[model samples]
Target: MQKLSELDHQRRIRLVDLHEPQFERDYPHIDRNAALAALHGELPDGQVLKGLDTSHRAWSLVGRGWLTAPLRWPLLRLVADGCYRLFARHRYRISLWLTGRARCDGNRCGPKT
Candidate 1:
């Protein structure tokens, strides 16, 4: 997330900590429990979007837009979604293997639970 925030030179993305006290007050429409379980997005118009597809679309705004452009193709999008799910499911384990840490502390990766 820090890397992605740095890449967002326009400062368009707001990184909100789910555990923060003000999270519910600020994003009243979002269900904290569900958000902790998966990626979620609240658009400017208050539309709540979820899953890796929404995440990739949001990433398109940054310099990495080209990477997600292939998602326009239906087949590639389907494959990408599957890969995203797999990654999300085992991300903590993958982080442990790659970085020698669970990467869950400080809510850096995702919910501790």
Candidate 2:
């Protein structure tokens, strides 16, 4: 938690647990441009950053496969498949963290009500 606090303090990352009521209240007001700006600010000067994220659903598998279709000749599919299986089995929540698909139906993800 301390490390997370430090990271948040530095604006290196914004941690939002979907189950938090505050997120429900603040989601509508979060400015995507400002979030992008914060992300850029967290990086070192003169560095460039680009983000690519997708849902953890079946359709996204096709999207990812299509996006990397050009690299099939180099056996990249094996690597991508391995990563997908690993995350799906052990770190599925992390895989869907940004998408909020991992939120518990109950209050299990955050403080109990």
Using lDDT as the measure, which candidate wins? 1
Please give each candidate's TM-score. Answer: 0.79, 0.28
- The whole-model lDDT of each prediction reads 0.76, 0.39
- Per-prediction tally of clashes: 0, 0
Model 1: per-residue Cα lDDT over 18-104, one tens digit each:
878899999888898778766788778877777765677578768686776786578787887777778877878888898776767
Question: Model 2: clashing residue pairs?
Answer: none
Model 2 per-residue lDDT tens digits across residues 33-93:
4333222111234333222221212112333335435334357646765564555444436
